[model samples]
Target: MKKLMNFKGLLLSGMMMLGMTAFAQDGASTTENYDQGFRLGFGLNGGVTTGDYFNFALGGDVRLQYDLSQRTSLTLTTGYTHLFGEDNVPDLGYIPAKAGFKAFVWGDRFYVLGEAGAGFAVTNDYNETTFLWAPGIGYANDVIDLSLRYEGANDFKTDQVALRIAYGFKL
Candidate 1:
């Protein structure tokens, strides 16, 4: 358990360092392309969960996004999810790490996204991990992002439908 926690910490730190390096490179670009380069964002979400477990989930995530073209971007995300339990179920928590792509389907502000990764669940009884994925549509601008998504795990019985709102700045 201690080793697993340490490994998770190390992985997150490494990812953050990599993201910072990318942001620094984008910031140092000499061409006008710098304005269209990479960006970093953070978000918070709260919603209800169903399918085997019924609960309220709240989560916060960080994303490093790189523009692939005028209408597309690649994103890497890491977050913590907490599910409030009811009745006999215990409170559950997860650390989700994922990579995805976002593309503007209608215009520069509206997009669709799909991400797949793993979720590490931690609890007093046992620690487990499972495959996780999400598919969603969103609207974004320079300062705000709003999205509705469905999140699920391959090994866990519960899934979630959430609406997330975020505030971000150019990096």
Candidate 2:
């Protein structure tokens, strides 16, 4: 009888400890869905440019991101961009791909990211090789992410800038 009572006491004690730990952990938790796993996203942005040519452009970008650490990630993004205006002479539609570093600032809900890469512009004169950079900020909820980005490029001798916004879904 004494042995049985000791076993029961141990079991009850273990359950109580688990309950206390869970209560303590709940208060400091950031992303409740960390176990949801993997993230993907897309977004659209419209902004004016200031550089060699000034113009208004719209772009749509898609991102595939993986959690490298609890709040740090790596992302690969590709965007289809179009810039057209009477003043902005080049008028371009190009596909750009970037690989960058991203880190979440306020838990998993907010982030800041930057990327540097190269791109090719599809144009009437010729396919142009360009170097590009992007820095952006983002917000996320479960399953969706959004961002506003500043994009810059050096095409031959001219440099240009554009603003873009995007939305992405986790998969």
Candidate 3:
């Protein structure tokens, strides 16, 4: 029994080490492109959510990014989303101002990013304020970009999955 347990532990440790190595290798592909410069882009995305209510939403966002280094950047995002009818929860909207860090791999076109920021309600009926945070995987080409993210808000203890797609110039 003792030998069997020892062998199991060793096997688990070996698998863990292998997984770590794979992740590190994937992380090594990150490279710099157009770093230390300013980039502005805009995009639109629509999706559905489930939880408090099953609803559909569409949103547009604009972002300005400043690359502080090859592996790091700071971004500011402002955006609004409109949720469709569900449970009489009139279409909801928000304007979010966020700042976060981004890390890139496979050049500037693919990345892993996370950001935290605050948002305020724009409509009179929805004077609620909330903090937002998201971690996403993104891909961009010369003409188009897309991202998948999970967004969380503190006020409602709510979380949603977001899919964003945009077309913008890389200047």
lDDT (0 to 1) per candidate:
0.75, 0.64, 0.67
Tens digits of per-residue lDDT for model 3, 1-171? 465447435644653453344335444434445346777889786776544643766789998878777655688888886656577666567787888766665555676677789877676477788997766768876667788766666673344667988775646
Q: Is candidate 1 or candidate 3 better by TM-score?
A: 1
- lDDT (tens digit, per residue) of candidate 2 on 124-169: 5648878877766677776656666556676733333344445555
Q: Give the TM-score of each candidate.
A: 0.77, 0.69, 0.73
The whole-model C-alpha lDDT of candidate 3 against the native structure comes to 0.67
lDDT score, candidate 2: 0.64
Model 3 residue 31 distance off true place after TM-score fit, in angstroms: 7.9
> Could you tell me the C-alpha RMSD of candidate 3 in Å?
9.0
Off by over 4 Å in 2: 1-37, 156-165
Clashes by residue pair, model 3: none
Model 1: ten consecutive residues of lowest lDDT: 20-29
